[model samples]
Target chain A: MSNTKLVLVYKGFERFWHWTQAFLIIFLAVTGFEIHSSFSLFGFETAVNLHNKAAWALIILIIFAIFWHITSGEWKQYLPTTKNLKAQIEFYLTGIFRNTPHPTKKTVLSKLNPLQRLVYLGLKILVIPVMVMSGLAYMFYRYPQAGIIKSANMEDLEVIAIIHTFGAFVLVAFVIVHLYLITTGHTITSNLNAMITGWEELEEDENEPSVNDEPVFVTEPKI
Target chain B: MQNFKPILTFLFAVIAPLVIITLALREPETDHELLNQLREKYTHQHKLGIDHSKLAILQQDFTNPHAITAACLSCHTERGQEVLKNAHWNWEREAFIPGRGVTYLGKKNLINNFCTGIASNEGTCNRCHTGYGWQDETFDFTNEYNIDCLICHDNTNTYEKQKGAAGYPVMGADSPDFRNIVGHVGRPGRYNCGYCHFHSAGGNNVKHGDLEMALLTADRTIDVHMGVDGLDMSCVECHPAENHQMLGRYYGVSSSNTQRATCEQCHGSVPHTNSKLNEHVVKVDCRTCHIPTYAKVNPTKTYWDWSTATKRQDGKPYELVDSVGNVSYASIKGNFHWQKMAKPEYYWFNGTADHHLISDKIDLNNLPMKINTMFGDYHDKQSKIVPMKVHRGKQPYDTENLTIIQPKLWDKEANQGALWIDLDWEKALEKGMEYLDMPYSGKHGFIETEMYLPISHMVSTSDQALSCVDCHTRNESRLANLTDFYMPGRDQNSTLDTIGKWLILLSLAGVLLHGIVRVFISRKNKIAETHK
Candidate 1:
């Protein structure tokens, strides 16, 4: 009667990428906040240099991620889906709080819920791209007439910057919700361990196909 | 042990306030006997009083062609005397129409250094304008020192007149001079600076911002030839009270360290928030940029568009060009004016950082007051910065008001160089092991990264090379952070703000109307359905 079923889904590189990107982004946000003088977690100048370096590192990681996703065809995992759309919405509104049974059972083949697929798709397509573009604009923009910067436009940076910061806030909010949802998966340790060790103990009954079917693909167990 | 004996002095200091209160309550004797002696020295030319008390130390013998023995004169040599000669003695300089009249000492200038006129800008400069005292309606500038000793010497003068002291309409006062003139801070200022600064005083409406020449007035022109002497301001307001051992000069090329609210007084924020640039603003001046002398102009007004900068009055050759091949020349004309012609010059971006940031022809004569010198100084007579900049050397930076600017390259470029690496071992190692190699490249353990050079804290524009990013970076560009925050440099969207406000109001009204209509329609629809 265990809710957990043994499944091998997440790969070693995926775990590595997820944790590294998370740490790097959190580091960047912390240092970036300090640079903005939102609060001085690190000293001002140090924060600025750290933020700049972190930005460069994030760019590099993004490039590597794009390559990894494309080569492994993992990028397709975030494509939007409508299966269990009603269940996903209901779960968010009521089931989540009441601990009702999940409408879409998770398996090695299709690890993400419908809502996650949709949100992750939007983030990859819309938010992250905008954040990188606007951040670049702020780092490199200028006016040539008045000798030195005629004005120091920092706070509500240009229009694009507002979009970039808004994207950042969304990412932060998603991270918060994502962490909470992670705890709801099977046994908390099982879901957490999958991200760390690339394996999850899933319910064996979830092998049954869903009403609106999605083909499940499981890899050979590494161990 | 000997110092401990002053208990009685400490007791007196504690009781001083009570003593002052007692004095205020009682009638005091008049000190007119001292005034008569001062009057005697003035009438007969006794060559005394320059070294008198700080309040009434009249510059009797200190006047030119006359000599005064002074604490300053004793130490300063001939060269020092020459330095001291600068109008440090000139308590004030007011703008006067040259045709009106002249002073009796073979001086044709009729400028009056009236207290309200020059130091404390009472704003109504017309009230203290020359020809006569506009305030009293009786005193004339053709005569001299009608306001008495406190007029120039005492920044704060409180006369006790309940029994015998002078009251307001009797003596004027300004609080502790920012210069701490004679080191008496915490004392009420003896004069009024607002008299010379306010716009009505015939000066710039504000001290900083958009370089509009319209604020320039006849009374506070930077050009001496334009009769700047008539303005309601003077030297000590910007310059320091203490000077070189030679009497009145300081060691630096810029004469004063005075902090002026002129810029921030109007511009909402302190520009000093930026360390590197703010330090430069302190060392240099506002004239380094907006001075018309830097702008190339045309000799004749006929075909000239002043904004295009077609000529320079310094007689120095100037070459300027626009994006296309449009060319113009900056030529020197005969009355020290610049002639204009369509000939292009080289761009400022040709070499490294602006080589022409400061023109070489520039020399610091009058130490820092460069107007019409062979150097490129805009001696603006009708300057927008009237009363303040016009009254130079008066408000030099105070030592007590220390503004420190500390700039570090660490924030923008995360990699620490050898110097910083040694200084911050923890962060360096934490960042990466790569931080260790910077210190000694030639030693057994070698590192290849660039050495960290600690630059002198001078904001001067040097001809050092810069990368493409230097110009491209937002922070480095002249379009400062406020550009995005406050519609660039101008109130560009203020009109838009009005439109936005009105739009909000209309939207609210429309929303209310729409809500009412929807409610009415829903009710009607509900009744019809019910009837059906």
Candidate 2:
């Protein structure tokens, strides 16, 4: 293993934001489901209020994240890629089990692997937008001329409602799968530790390119 | 980065208001300013608590309730009690009861479906139940009848706190004013009935009756003319003694307080709005207007009744077909009777017999050469849109299919609203073709132009038809009309009373699938990167 100098990749606020956001998302999902009857943690009313507040907080955080990404150009890092894709797929299917080398390497500029890039890109494009739009729609919903509705035919409310609940379920499914994947990290706790301390130890590969003219297998701590 | 300066300015303009609002909200309460300062400034002795602030709040809540039962029971005793018994009471339960436990009960059934669903399956339903404490996960079924009283009486407060009740303390104790009259009297309109009528997650605040509950009560009430007042003619006087409740209610409603003569006492010969009802295209009354043959049509107890807006037969649309037109009900010996509510049978259509036949408009010569008509279908997927063929009443296109000797003749006796039905106006569309003649066209300016339009061209906003939004503004989208749909909350698969409730459940499922794919692909990449 070639020794390499540790370099900071993640800023302090980024980690704080990521963890706080994770905590809030989990809190929101639990309370939201409780409010929706999937399960209950907080009482319905409290869960409603907490869900609302958390949602608002998340919106605020998203606004801030958007600002941060725009300013720092980090959003560009999530651009979908198909580069060196075959080996990446094989690594997950068989190579990882056989202790084969990683198909794609990570760089400071490119924190996400190709597959991760595509997925993150998709989430940014599809999932989050639906959740935000649906949530906003649910909060501000109303039926004007409420009392007069009986006389008028109610056949008009067909499409809007389906979208709101559908968005909610999507967020719900994401939360469920995201929770299970946390255990898939290196050594189970290794990924967890990286999120916590912003550091990860990797094996050195002679064929790998170096960032600062150092051996590729060095300690990297991005915080 | 494109059009950076203009976009920046536009974005700033939008966000500037938000920042200002946030700053304003963050500022301390300005209304809490010392009365001492105002008093000193004027030095004129003023009635300290003189305010109609509560009425404004009451009105706002009645218009849009943040919480149910709390805004209603303040004034109407009967409606208040009904609200208390309703399921909306459990919108949030307290911790003392099962998450699904009852909070307030008033000698009625208290086993809440909401509670039952939550306790065993979730053990979490108690959270939304009344006074539910999420931490301990407990519920109390004691005060569950709150929705019943609150929605009707709109007393928003406990008995002692409400203003203007007869039991309210005399001047030496409690005073009466707008600020204090949190829940007092209600005028006649939709709010008078909206106590339970307006809706559910069940669909667009569905009102069983044509009356707009929000319009029922008024701060400045319109003069109620009980032509032959029911005995003393005081609606809120005897039954509730304080609030309004007609006699004979099993629960909190004034069930056995018979006051039949009161209907005749003040309303001696005529009924209020009777002249208007008689003049309208159809003859109707409260007893007749709300004659629902079906049970649970407006069941106050349930959170939602799925049967609303659906026909009982094929689970199709409510059949609002008006097959009854003016027909000859008289035989050789027609009785010319002197009366107020002229029986329709005496002059024309007998409800029992002449329903199938059509009537014709007669000229002085007694010949039905060309009977003018105006029945048109404005919107039905089945019916074709009959295009405009007339310009300002003069025929522009062929009048070959014009309603000359038309099958559907206008109801003649009642001028107040027949044109509405014949033309398909909105005010006369509820309660199986019951018609209401509102103060449209400034009391008599409505033009009577004969033109060939679809039966669907029922109501014309030619009055204020400048912009499409003006007529359609009642809702967000252009669904103010019967045929167009602006789906509420965009709630997909809205089975609960809302439209498309399960209308297109699969579309949402597709969106969910997309979301799942997005999350899975992203997670896979995250794991791979971690390994690398």
Candidate 3:
């Protein structure tokens, strides 16, 4: 039908990180909804224990993923670009449904589209961090200090709970959109297959560009 | 796979501290030696004032309680007379209740729900009486030696006046049980006072929900002031004795004493460091917050429906234990509802209480009578929110006379009319009224009644006090029944709440509509471009 070849796009660690992170997030959401008394699948106590354990596991995975990204120089993939960001939003809003050509290309150096980078960056910096910090605060709220087990003052607890719940809602919305986006690749199952097998089918024209074709702008020296 | 090395290291780095902290923060073993040392220190500090070796009168072989009192009076002459004037010894006091004028009320006069009254059954009831041998109405009250000093002053734990003994200690083969208690008389301990107070209404820890025999060895978590692990204070610390007259006074029962012990006496007006909490002291009693719940260790009787009492099919009285193993139904006492760790009912109470006297007429419209009513309100400047155990019951009353009837529960001679022996209510009432010289209408009915007992003891530590949400919540609040004034979180204005909710919904809808329009316009533009 078309000249297509399998390209080694996603690395081994990247695929592992993606699947593990997805499983963890899904598990967290299920347990979290149970803890919130939303159609309890597991009882409240069991859900709480599972949620806490999953949270700690996710935190550990996140920490290791951060180290791996920094070491492998793969952190550059998340750096957002302004060019074609408006076009990428337009593509999602109207063009994709109408069979219009995609605004951005996926290569080894640029796995995420411009709008994806912005959204993913926001999740990493704002929503995820907020959830993690608020969750930790809740977990250790009743930790003992100065011969007294100090609990969060009753007045302030409602605010913390609201912030945590709001973050969870944002994450849930992101996950729904992310699942839909997985089907928007070259084929319906192309993105999912790539994430599982570490290989993707790309158009010949969508190959990496030459260094001399575009001026590379370095932002800051690597840590 | 090479990434696993650094990843594992990172995971180890993060988890090590958490594990270590969790392990290190485990509660340490309690230091029993330190507790023993503290106990020894407390005992040494609170030694009695009297030297037993120097007091020759105390060493004498006493045959009767009166002889021992005579010996005690040999040195302390005014003590006997002073004690004689006390309501404990006299068993009657001039109570000047508001609106009722002055009336003599005490154990002698008041018809209590428990055991009814002391009238006509003085022998069995007078076992708790401070004076000796109060067998009948003709018993001498003016005798100075009749005062049982050993009942209040004995610390040997051996001085106990058994019921049916007429205010005398249990006797051995020939002499009073003087084994190991020859010279141990001192200021009263919790055991001495609890012997009577704790054992009121038939059994220990039965009458007052706040007081129990468990208090003798309670920990700080149970009771902060009286706990062995905390202050270990005796009853006298709060109810200080001066010239043989205790400072504490029962609200409705006793009105003779002007000096009543209050929380402010020790903690001062403002006890809390937080000024906002201290401000609440004006309208909230200290015990309301400090004592969140009552009967922490033992279950207390909350409801007693005496109307349920009847003979069993086997021609004997039946008894039924509840699911929790508490005596729920007894033929003698009737049906009881016991509650453990009970949240107290709150009310605005000043220092005064008005009791329903036996002579007072009850309005037929007021169906269930309030046996004792605590007086206060939100507008009263002297009033504060106080915690109380409102003991509810159904007791026999004169339906025609419109007064609560007293039944002779216990009789020394086992009279056929005695309620405890014969289990006949009519006969017991007839005999009890005849003995008191009061007219009975012969017609009787059981009426619901409530007795208000102000909760004072079993004070928990500050951390265990009620959280704000306990009372300031929309539903199931402790003060849900209290309708004095509006509380913020508990009450909501329906109009304002609806308006606020509608505004939020409108804002959400506006954002959604705006997004929908933008998407639609962008889609139309793209379609037009493609068509061109």
Candidate 4:
């Protein structure tokens, strides 16, 4: 406890984006499964209407998130490396039960571990794009007014629905694992509290460059 | 100019809010109100042009139906010639039945599930015919005086053909006054067309489920177009006549898609505020949703098992009523089933149908024979899902000839091989076969049959239109049987669904296991620290 110091790990816009995105994703899953006829919660018509509206909200949020990540240099945190990747896996497998230290350090510069970076990168580049594209296809499948765009009309909805549903399953799985891993921080509530209030207590070192000292690019930190 | 500008500004300020308040207080016109206004304007424009009572030619007392037609033809010289060419008079149309190659198909030759064919029963069925003296093949077709003009033009509502007098008016003391009826002729009303149409297979509402006697004075809920409370439209409004040819043609009698009276004639193809709903217009007919159920006020015949006929109560023909007071059984007809507010079955129809003609061969293995096959599928771009009353029944067919039997069901004289008189199937079949000049097999057996009757009337208002969940739901969907194409909520890939559920379950298990291990380690560490 004496070796640690409280520091800001999340910015205001970042926190807002993360929480709003989390709410929207949960809301979308509920409505999306209803559209699949899994169960009737909000009813078919209301669920479809809400699902379409929430999709637009998520798309707008994603644009803001991408802009913030690029401008704040937070995009660099997701760049993958083999460095400590094996150790992170090993820590979760057995070392976690034996009370061993974390393989990767959490700082303002690097928020995700090796495994998290890979998973999130796949989501942004693969899963999310597929979901959004297929969702847009569902929305614009028919254009009665556009007489010239008959060729652009999608003749089949089965393919689009399958792709969208597949992506939904993957997203739900990711959310579950992500929530569980939040407790793997320095303390059980440390990560959760940091996301909420934008501050976390990390191990302080005199040799390490702190946020108040200087701006340094630390791709791989030595423990 | 500055003083005048100030005065103008004061006047404008005073009038603006007053105008706004007046408008705000006045209620906006609903869709029904606007439609009623339009109907009122149309009614005012289409009054009867001439008074027939003022004409000197119509004042004479006609002794027979043919003499009345002759006197009417004196002034309307070309009307009788026009009526002669009409389908109403000839009971046949020059239609191109795909495989048959330019056949005259109609009630004259075609066999229906209800009454079979009209070849041997001309005298009884000709009560609906427009011309007089069509009792047999010897009846005149070229005579202009035989065309009965009073049947369609009689607005006095007293004109009615005798039961089996071959299109003649009832004679003797009980007959209608000819002089008074002749002076009151006008264009046909709803009852004029409905007199035969609504009573098609003998009784009221026996054939088409959407059309019944109740629609004559129906409210807006029961019917929007012909509702006395709403538009109060007539049959001729939609089925307008050019010369003697009407615009609308049913698939039962006519096969081609050329002369359809669709909603698009008045209401355009895209008639919805919701863009998604508007897109469905290309794939779904308006009747599929608007006329969700038919025979709403009265029960319609759904089934008629002719095999159950000929059951006599001590040698006397008798009829039985069901618990609901409907005719359940009769010695002449058969067992019957009726339904009220019946939901329609869906079919993909591109407006062309192929009928099972009387002379055509049949396969007994294919039971529940499709008397009329509506040709289309999901792949056909021209096809749309239409609502229809699929009347199921059993009718006699030849066991050896493999053809449907057209029995002599009615006659003006008894002991002349009429089923209604003797209840003898063999004699009726022999007489009917002799009339068609076709050989009878001497063996008759009942086969299950189905008739597709298109539902075009009794359309409800917009509020009663089918909701999205009605067909798009997983359970009890109206279109559940139409499985050729994918519907979003109703259909799903089973393989994908199974994998999806497993993925969710396994992820849950993985998280729960990881949580348990973490809690165990943390509790163990706390105990060791406290002991130290």
Identify the candidate with maximal lDDT: 4
- Candidate numbers sorted by lDDT from highest down: 4, 3, 1, 2
Cα-based lDDT at residue B288, candidate 1? 31
lDDT of each: 0.36, 0.34, 0.74, 0.83
Best to worst by TM-score, what's the order? 4, 3, 1, 2
Which portions of model 4 miss their true places by more than 4 Å? Answer: A1-3, A143-148, A204-209, A213-223, B1-45
Which residue ranges in model 2 land beyond 4 Å of their true spot? A1-6, A144-160, A202-223, B1-532
Question: Chain B TM-score of model 2, please?
Answer: 0.21
List each candidate's DockQ score: 0.02, 0.07, 0.04, 0.30
Candidate 3 DockQ category? Answer: incorrect
Two-chain complex of model 1, DockQ on C-alpha atoms against the true structure: 0.02
DockQ of 2: 0.07
Using DockQ as the measure, the top candidate is: 4
If you assessed candidate 2 against the hidden native complex, which CAPRI class would it receive? incorrect
Model 4: which residue pairs collide? Answer: none
B343-417, model 2: which lDDT tens digit per residue? 111111111110000111223243222112222232322121121111011111112212111111123233333
- Looking at model 4 chain A, report the run of 10 residues with the lowest lDDT sum: A214-223
Candidate 3: C-alpha lDDT: 0.74
Give RMSD to native, each candidate. Answer: 28.8, 26.6, 11.0, 8.0
Q: B386-493 in candidate 3: lDDT tens per residue?
A: 898888898888889888788777776655587777778889888888888887999988988888888898889879987655665566877777676544345544
Clashing pairs in 3: none
Ranking by DockQ: 4, 2, 3, 1
Q: What interface RMSD does every candidate have?
A: 19.8, 13.3, 10.5, 8.9
lDDT of 1 at A134: 80
